[model samples]
Every structure is written in C-alpha cells, then in structure tokens.
Target: MDNFLIITCVHHFQKDGKFYGYGPFIREMNLWIKNRKKVTVLAPLIYSGIPGKIDLEYEHPHLNFKSVPAYHIQSWIARFKALFQVPYILLMIFWEMSKASHIHIRTPGNMGLLAMFVQILFPFKFKTIKYAGNWDPKSEQPHTYKIQRRLANSPFFTRNAKVLVYGNWADNSSNVVPFFTASYSETEIEPVRKSSLKEKIKLVFVGSIYSGKNPEVGIYLSKILKDKGIDFEFIYCGDGVMRPQMEELSIQLDLSENVKFLGNVTSAEIKSILKESHFLIFISKTEGWPKAVAEAMFWGCIPFTSPVSCVPEMVGNGERGVLLSTNPEEIYLALLPYIDDEELFQKTSKQAMDWSRKFTLEKFQKEIVNLECE
Candidate 1:
C-alpha cells in the first residue's frame, strides 16, 4: 500500500506539534503505520485541552491529521446538533478515505458509526476495523452500537474489510477476525509471583470510575470484604465522574482504612501495582476485551471479573481467575477459596501469566505485518 489512512472515533488533540489521545489506541495505530509510506488520520481535534496522564500521540513524521467536527448522541439538543454535524463528519470521512490505500476504523463511537456507513460507498477499498467495545452478539447496547455491528458484520455490505474483534464467536461473518491489543514489550516481561494467602491482600481496580465501567462495584466489594472481617486493601487506579461518589460512599461505609483512590496513574505505576497485587477486579457491565485484566494477568494477578463478552475466554472460563456473579454473596464465596489455598492460587496466577504474555506488542506488530501481506 502506498498510503495508509486511519479514521477513528478516538478524539486526538494537538499540543506542541504532537498529537495526543488514548495511549493504547495510539500504540496500536503506531504498529499499523510501521510499513506505510504516507499516513493520514481523520479524527476530532479537540484543540483547547491538555493531554491527560494516559494520553499519547502518533510519532509518525510524515503524518497528516485532518480535523473534523465531533458529534454526540446524548441529549435532544446534542442530537439536534448532530443532525447537522454528523453529515459534515461523514463527508470528511469520505473525503479522507477516498485518498487512502488502506482504511482503518476504530469503534464503537459516533465517528465509527459514520465510518461504517461511509465505507460502504467504497466497497473494493482495503479496510480494517477495530471494534474495541463489547463484541458479544447477545449483549444489550444502544441502537448506534447495534447498527455499527450490523453494518460491519454484513459480509456483502462491508466488503474488503477485516473487522478485528475481541472474541471468537459461534457464527461470525467471514470478515470478522479475532484480535488482541498489547501493552508491554516482549523485553519487559519478567517473572511475576503472587499469592492470595498473604497477611494483607492487595486488590486493584484499573479502569475508569463510572457507570459503564462500574468502578463503584469494586468499592462495594471491598466494603463487603471488610464487613466480613477480611483483610484486604482496595486500590483504584483510574479516574472518572464517579470518583466523588466512590469517595463519599467509602467514607459512609467506614472503609477509610481499606479503600484508596489513586486516581489516574502512569503505565509504569500501574504495572508495578499489578505485579505486587494478588487480584485485579473488573466487574463491568460490558466490555470488548478488558486490556487491564490481561495486563494484570501478565503480572501474575488473578482477574476477578464479570463474565461479560470475551472476559470468560480471556480468563480461561474462571480457570485462571474468579468469574463472579453480580450478587455480593456469590462473589464473596468465589473469592473465599483463593485466600486459603496457596498452591491453587499460584497455579491460577501462573496460568494467567503464561497465557497473557503470549500476546505482547512485538507479537502484535508481527501480526500487523502479516495482515499487510494479506
């Protein structure tokens, strides 16, 4: 391919001539651009903001970033605005995708939904889509999300597109490819050893603190453990709208000594914390692939998560971690076994670590190279 163009939903901002957005998205896109001569990105450029702790940018020198209007489907007013804004964005997407040798779309977002529809006009173009949300065919989601999935899954409609999704489903379209995102380099892999039968267990929550991620559930679980006289420390490593609520509830539940909100931390700090912690909690309502769960597993931390989407597959159907019910009593029982048996704990940890380490950034890059060859 002569030119590689990526149209994504992730909002990127420019600062000091550098583009910044989500770190993991940028990392994966970096791999996608490795062998291309020219690269262009058509995304929202939020110009008035500084980079966050996890925000990063594309480092490609010959990069062209085309700015487009961002749209939201939240309120009536936003929807009214989107009626005018969405078409503009779609036209921009069509303009950019038309000039590319390859088209890559990142979902599930408003931009991705637009891209899915826009891409249909160019049926013969080479395209790849990373559907980075819940890929469960049975999961409940918004209408936009369902429409995006339907458009991408229809083999005839979304032709010449490799939809890289999180899990292996029973009857997916031929275009649907199972894919994984990476965090650490192969050289960064070290021997990690953790056991739950310690004097004090360290539990980590590594996602956003909001309703979608259900970060409050982690605090509630910790409170339940505390009330039962269990000795554990809850560490929240992300920030969101629910941080204030989590803080207030922790205080009300008398979990001051047990729960600690670390806010958004650096990748290195997160890695260090995971390496030391015995368990990682990710009881979310939905997910595509919980990258944090896999990252924690790579450091010998067992995943204590809901069986949503591909989580059961990622955690080996509760073989390498704890698959929990929404009920507090059931979750408590599921975790109780881990705190007593050292051998079982070590086995599970090792199983998780060995499985997760197989999908490093090096491997991810090679896979991209192979995809290019195809």
Candidate 2:
C-alpha cells in the first residue's frame, strides 16, 4: 500500500464533510491517486457554504487533508502576513514529507516553492514535481517562478525527482521530462463533422472572462466580423468578475444579439458546444498548457490562440489552427484566409483532431502509471 503526498496551491473547499476543488485540477489529481491505498493532500482549504458550479469532489476511500492558509505578496499587508505564515507552512510540509512514501509537488505556486525546498531534505525519497507552467527558457516570468524552475531542474537540489514540464526544453537534466495534459479519453473520441462556414459563423470562448484571458478580444473580433456585414455568434463559456464589464462592452458594441454568455457550464456542455462551433477565439496573455486550446482541438474546433507557452507546438505552427494576435485587425487578417476556404478549414480541423487525439486521458493515465513504476 503506497501513501502518496501531494502539495499544491490549488484551493480546496469544505462543505458538508466533503472536499471539493476546481474541476480540471481535481480530475487530474484523481488520476494520480486512483491506484494508491492512502492519499494525503496539503493545500489551502476554504470553508464555503456551497461549492462553485465547476468544482468537483475528490474520489478516494482513504484520504487525509492538511489545510494551510493561502497567501500572496501582491500588497504590503499580504507580504507581512505571508512572512509570519511561512514558518508554519514549511513545518507542516516537512512533517508531511517525513511520513509519505512518495511526494508530488505542483509548481509555479507559493506552496510549491516551499515544498520544493522541503523535499531536498529527503534526498533519497521518491518525488515528482509537476511544473504546470511555461517551461520556455526564454519566456519572462516572476522571480519566484524562475527560482522554482531552476530548483526543479537542478539535480543536486531535486534529487530522486522527475520534473514534469509542459514543453520540450533544451539544456535540462535527465530528470526534466516533457509532459502534456489531456481532457478527453479514447472512448470519448467520436467523428466530429462540423458544418461549413456560412454567413452565420459560430465562435466560442472557453475560459475565465478576465484581463489575463483577454476575453475582450473575442468581443472585438465579433465586432469586426459584424462590421464587415458577416453574421456571427460569439459564445463565452466560463464566468469571472469581468463578466459584467464584458457584457456591457458587448452591448455597447451592439453585439447583444451576436454574443451569448453561458457562465460556468458543465464539461459536457462545453464539449457539445465545441463540437458545433467553427472556432475557439482565445487570445490570452499567458498560459501553461491551455486546456481550452487542446479541448477545442479535440472536438475539431480550430483554436485561434496567442502563441504562448506550448501553444505554437500544439497548433503545429498554424497548421492545425491559427496563431492569433491580440490586435483585432491582425487577428482578422490571420483568420480571413480560413473563413471562406472550406477545404483549408476542413484540412486544419482534421490536423487538429489528429494531433490532439494522441494525448487522450487513457494515454495520460498510462503515463502516470509508468512514472510511478519508475
């Protein structure tokens, strides 16, 4: 019986004697711990009256949860509070590390940073570090993020650990392994036949409607299409604090009829929408793997996304989908070639489906099992 310890920054909620967390994160964790006899999680805990629509419960028989305060250094007050809290958090992590057979650290987060250091004390213990962030050496990131990356890739510090990164990076130790995330499974693969682009083209966005995700760019693209006398429908799938502002912007742009906000829908609904949509417009400022892009591709929804992190590799450098620019005019010009070209659109869609199908949930789970054996 293996005892697995996972330390992450993902917030877990407690309600009615049950634990819930963000859907995608929880789903991936479920796969990691499915075969283990006992699972222990060290993360921030929140007592909420009700879980969000996109939250899911952990599926395990034997579970141990250690709650830690979530902290940030965005403000002076926060920094001061974190300074006092770090010692307690580190102690908890070290205590947990001593008891576990295997340690898993999810990185590019405050909690992950502490865990990375704590794991070094047990140099011979089996460990895995999932660096769920941009692994591109050339990309600019926060100082702490860079520190975490360096520590994870350093053999002397991260001994007996496999550092799982999103993209294939050069000049890394043998422990640094390139990995991918998946949404659908082999059994879920179905023949997706999308209708040809017509006067009414369907464009969808699946993610938080916030500044970081740049949801406004989708609206601007819709405005451009409308101004060109093209009939279109833009759908926003996820919700955030920016929804109200984006809704107002859509109204101001006279896109009330063309834009629809389906805030926080189920995964099934998003998959269904993706199957019918013509394209996924995601012009985010940054991303790790961008599950939305991969999910969109899985359903043959060609994603017009910014070339961030591993996105260019995922899209095959515009062969599977268009690499987007935040500028609406530039995005329009990039997309103009594919709009009316049915043969090109079909070819790209096929390419996307073919590439994305290679990374199914089945494959992801098998990879996890292989990692555990190693």
Task: Work out candidate 1's RMSD over C-alphas.
Answer: 1.4
- Model 1 misplaced regions, further than 4 Å: none
Q: Report the lDDT tens digits of candidate 1 across residue range 1-374.
A: 57898887778888889888888788888888876789999888898888899887887888988988788867999999998998888788889888898999988988888899999999989899889988888899988999999999999889998999999887689889899889989999888756446688888999889898778777778878998888889899999999999999999999989999999888889999999999888888998888889899999998989889888988888787888866766767777777878788888999999999999999999988777577
Give the Cα lDDT of each candidate. 0.87, 0.91
Which lDDT tens digits does candidate 2 get at residues 168-203?
Answer: 778678888889998888999999989768756889
My TM-score estimates for the predictions, one after another, are 0.96, 0.97
- Model 2 misplacement above 4 A: none
- Root-mean-square deviation (CA) per prediction: 1.4, 1.2
